[model samples]
Target: MAGTVRKKMSRFNSMISLDEVSRIVKAYSWKKLSTVEVETATSVGMIAANTVVATKDFPPNPRSLVDGYAIRSAETEGSSPADPSRFKIVGKSEAGKGFYSAVSGGESVEIYTGGILPEGLDAVVMAENATVSGDTITVSSSVKAWENVASRGEDLSAGTVLVSSGNIIKPWHLPALTDGGIDRLTVFSPMRVAVLNTGDELFPDAPDHIENSGMSSMMALLPWRFSNTLWIGQVHDDPDDIARAVKESSDRWDLAIITGGSSLGRKDEVPEAMGIAGAIEVFGGMRTKPGRTTSLYSLDGKPVLSLSGFPSTSILMADLIVEILLEAITGVSGYRIRERLPISSDITTGSGYTRLIPGTLVEMNGRTMVAPASSNRGMRLGSLLNSSGIIIVPEWVEGYHSGDLVEFRLW
Candidate 1:
């Protein structure tokens, strides 16, 4: 009955599976990185270049790892609490100072934290474990050679791959890169993308109109949002208007995104408009719920991702589709929001359509469960204000009882 109803509607193009669409994007993906020398301080959240070799060997010299008595391992080999090992402290080694004297048979050096290790002294006893007299320190514990000693080049080599390419520089990775003398790096330029909100009823700021225009607000968060998301604004249902916007924007954008008109099930004008333009490739019309109306095409050899106008469908589809395409192009996989949870309540869903529900994941009885929030599709824009992610359930499942594990991604 459902298939019959779907067939009755005009199927302009055959629906393709998610993997098939992914393959098409993979084939069309291209990486043209922009070269810009960014300060190490400013490039904290960007991808790394090929690799950055260490400018100099880390540590550069043997250093003390603790504040204790630095002594030759042989001198402390037979030391014990009953027969404490006594060594004459000839000199003190503070941080940045090199101990020039060599520790002989019963000699030791007083080394502070980070101080240069004295010659011939391979181990150090912690200050708490050793007793210091007027001119000698007694360590009762035995230690092997090189204990608590940081050898030169132990942390980083002179020429090593600090951070490789395709890595999104995180806060933690920055310190290592900067401290390793990688103050400059080559990062892939941001993807050039433009937003084309289709349909005549869609308004950029109108409360009701904007809400109806699918996942429009997510743009402000895109990596290229502030600089490259040419909000090219809205295009009417007219074929000419949509075609012109696609052509004009295609020049400035490596990829153009049109929200709302790709769905031919409704009175959608996007597919028709793209046909009238120079050239395009449509790989949507999938047998999926919420996002089935989504499609992607390449206008004039430039890629464009088309999405349904519904906010729920748009948001969910954007997370999946954009990451898939961009990863192939730039190797950036964005963020993943994970809060392990089960179905809050039993769900009775029919077979043959992939399902994605905007859910409120909560902890109940020491287990997280997802509860469906709304099914309005495009009607509930405010519904996402508190939402985290969509629980994607495959189309083949009969239903899921409360307490089934499902993972979600952040918007």
Candidate 2:
């Protein structure tokens, strides 16, 4: 409802370009979703709602990274195995304990890994490099300042951002957050999404292949990609039922995706039903192959996507366009890894439309290459399992030659 436009256009002739769709979506005033505070270690798969900064240095004090003797680097500057430097062992430092006395030029402190260094000490000579006998240590090689010693704030300084807003929380993030003294994090609550399949041929037990493909794919992907809680339902090819389902979904869900009945076919009632549901049209269609009928709308301040009935078309549209909308609304980013890689073979696309070809990442002569998948062209269910990524061909560029670098996204 908030980002809706009241304009009308011929679905087939006046389809908007993909660039225009992106511009419009970017211009929309999408507010971030609600947030909840969760323990940092348990927040994986959730989107961070705020930036988490370090409260204190990761290493609160200078500490030893190895079991070694803490000594001044200058004391062993010219020492070698032929004429070794000597130091009198004064005290010992273990984890959670620090040697109180400072080490002078000829003195050293026995220190274990993670032990706080003695005062005035700036380096550690690893145990293997030193031989000790009754309070006397002989260093075989020279030691540099800060060698084997972790300095204060070496890993993370206070005020350093541990995690940024709009980034998905990952497993590796937990240690960083904890090291930064962040025990809890504010993350966006999981968005609730609904997939409404509309086709007269659909049934609960057995459904049309195309319709089931779109529904099942969305069902599996929503949780894995955006972490959205999903609901699946179906309606017959009637304008009233479609309108009712659309309205209900808008009232109860964050986003609703209606597959099938989006094209300008005799049985396609979604366009007319959207009007009945008081949905404001964002765009009637997009200038893209296979998903040219993909449309977007806003109802009650919520996003509603209308995708093609074809399997590959609907799935691709959901993956590309719906993800953008979700990011706009949720402030989450970087769900897929993008790469610029060489193509395994030559490929061509239509002149006026941006083409998305499902592809496989292959190793040709030990280098990863992108090759267009054969099943994707026919929009078969096998395409889903076979393709590992999508190769994007710009609308202006007609084709690419073998070995040409192109952009793609791993699914």
Pick the TM-score winner: 2
TM value for model 2 = 0.90
- Summarize candidate 1's per-residue lDDT along 353-405 as a digit string, tens digits: 76666777677888666777665343265666677677666677766787776
Q: Give the per-residue lDDT digits (tens) of candidate 2, residues 37-92.
A: 99887888888889889999979999999998999998898898998999999999
Backbone clash pairs in model 1 (N, Cα, C under 3 Å; residues 3+ apart or in different chains), count: 0
lDDT of 2 at 257: 85
TM-score of each: 0.84, 0.90
- The parts of candidate 2 lying over 4 Å away from their true place are 1-9, 96-105, 204-211, 224-226, 375-377
Best by lDDT: 2
